[model samples]
Target: MAYKSLLCVLTDSDFLEAPLAQGMALAESQDAHLDVLTLGVDRSQNGYFYAGADALMMQEMLARARSESDDIEAKCRQLLQNSELRWACDSGVAQIADLGRHVAMRARFADLVVLPKPYGPNHGTELEPTIEAALFEGQAPVLMVPEDAKPITAPETICIGWNESAEALASTRAALPFLKAAKTVHVVVIDPPVHGPNRSDPGGLLSQFLSRHGVRVEVDVISKTQPRVSDCLLRHATDKSADMIVMGAYGHSRFREAILGGATRSMLENATMPVLMAH
Candidate 1:
């Protein structure tokens, strides 16, 4: 029920400090082992066009990638050398399109996957695919940490975004450890259906289920005041001064969510707090 092994995946050096710090703090708190992976994108995978005319350009790109990887690995080792936590640092390069699978392969052996916020002012969109791969392919919960997030040994209050879908159930189950440790857990449901099986009482079943596990749980059924469900959830969590939010990722198809913009996309792009998600 507790995280014993944590994996931190870093693609570049732009927002490395926050995730590394967070991973180390969590590992120290849990007395667990931490593994840091510095992944570089291989530009030579798509250098077919430079076979004869522009081969030197491709070589230069490959050399740059190697240099970046070496720099990141050195930085990680320097930061982790003085720490008393059990940790290891490794680096690898993969094609941009296949980076997700490579990350997922390593993630399969870890209890929890720690990653930088894929969509934010401090991060680029390159990590989005890797996050998805870890969530779906690796079959492990993913924690996305913001660049300016305060270090937390454990969350005091948590909010769960509920929709009664299989994905939501999976995330809720995955977050039981945190819920059991939190002082209060809120199962927030927005605009519940009027004709579902639990129409008479929305979120009550979940509250009861959590209570059986010694969690101080409550249910909040609120109307959707904002255009998107994610906005309502974030506002409520902020109002409650919750330290973290746990919810399912991509309730809808990824393609549909990307094209039409679902709650998952909105939360990934705009959330200021740490979000733990599973598929």
Candidate 2:
């Protein structure tokens, strides 16, 4: 019901401040231990180019990676030095292809993983693999913070995107602590099917369930007037002045979402506020 251990994933990028600040703030607020993992990834090397001088090229790349990792670790320590929260900093070097598994190994021990938003102007595809690993391989809920996001000690108003899928259920369960602590919680259902389990009531069942858990909850059934369901959810959250949005991730296959665009991908790319997601 509460997060006792937190993991913050970082890379050797300029987008480190947001996730670090968010992680520390959450740890201070929840009275939890914080672990920081910085991954050093060098994308300048190609296997085809190192035909003759493989060993020397590999050695040089590793040395550069180690220096970057050390610098990142030093920066993390400097920022966390004065904080009273229990914390630790660690770093590793991994090839881009192996980054996901590397992060997943450490992510398995944490209650919740905090990560950088993988898509946006401030970020590239470097952290996308890591996020997928933390959610799917590690089987942990991930709180993604945008590069410009402000540190949230505790969210006051939260919006839950309800779809009655197993993934949504998992995310809602993972977000129970935040929902119970929030001043307001909105269960937003976007154009529910008239022939399904929620035919009689769109978001009523979920709202009732949350109310029993001491959540100040309400149901909002909105018509899908927008082009995408994510747009509707984001608009509703913004209207409600939500500090964070809680939703399931990748209800469809990752490859499908990547190629055809799904709600999860849209939310990840467009959400202005922090997003808590589980898969």
Candidate 3:
């Protein structure tokens, strides 16, 4: 019924404090076990592709990576030592592509996975792919904390982007812990299907289900046309002063979204608030 085990991925020095603090706070609140995972990118294969490149530069890069990973692990240990909840730290070194799989595999045993927004492509972090892997491969709900996400406060108001898809249902169920504690739960359905099981009463089924759990649920349908689903969801969240958003991770193929575009990708790229997503 609640998060009993939470995984928080630590990537960069610039982004560590927020997620670390947020994860610890959530663990404390739920009386859950917190696992801090620090990642170090493996670049040993780089020599094969860039045979002519300077070996010294690659060595320096690997050393820096190790140093940063150690720093993050140390910080996590220090923080965990002062926390009341059970906590542990784990560190690993893997190639960029392999790292995602590693994290996803670890996430499989967790109740909730926490990650930061992907670093900008130009920034060279390559942590974005891990987000997708964690959501889809790990088959778990992901709580993405924005860089600006401060120390966690229980969300009083939460907005759910509902479409009645399996993805949406998974996210809603995964978010029950938060929804049950929230003062207000708004199930916003943007442009519901004209004819389907939910056509007649979009959000009706889910709203009732939540109410049964003692959640203060409200259903809101945005009948007005909107340019993009993400825009509508964000606008509704803003209007309601929502602290967090719960929604499906990707309703369409990741490749198709990358080639075209999708709501999940839009939210991941632009959401200013914390987003809890599941695939």
Please report the candidate that would top lDDT against the real structure.
Answer: 2
Please list the C-alpha lDDT of all candidates, in the order they appear.
0.86, 0.88, 0.84
Q: What does the lDDT read for residue 98 in candidate 2? A: 72
By TM-score, who's the top model here? Answer: 2
Question: RMSD of candidate 3 to the true fold?
Answer: 2.3
Q: Between prediction 1 and prediction 3, which has the larger TM-score? A: 1
Q: Say which prediction, candidate 1 or candidate 2, comes out ahead on TM-score.
A: 2
- Model 2, span 27-144: residue lDDT tens: 9988999999987876554554667656867888878878878888889999999989999998998777677888889889988899988886656456788899999999999999
Q: For model 3, what is the error of residue 15's alpha carbon versus the real structure, in angstroms, after optimal superposition? A: 0.7
lDDT of 2: 0.88
Per-residue lDDT of candidate 3, residues 1-279 (tens digit): 889899998766667777788788888889899988897775455746676768787777778778878887887788788767888898866667567688888899999998887744433455677788788888989998888877554799999999888998999999999999999999999877788787888899999999999999999989646777998999899999999999998899999888898898888888888999999
What order do candidates take by TM-score, descending? 2, 1, 3
Inter-residue clash pairs, candidate 1: none
Off by over 4 Å in 1: 43-53
TM-score of each: 0.94, 0.95, 0.92
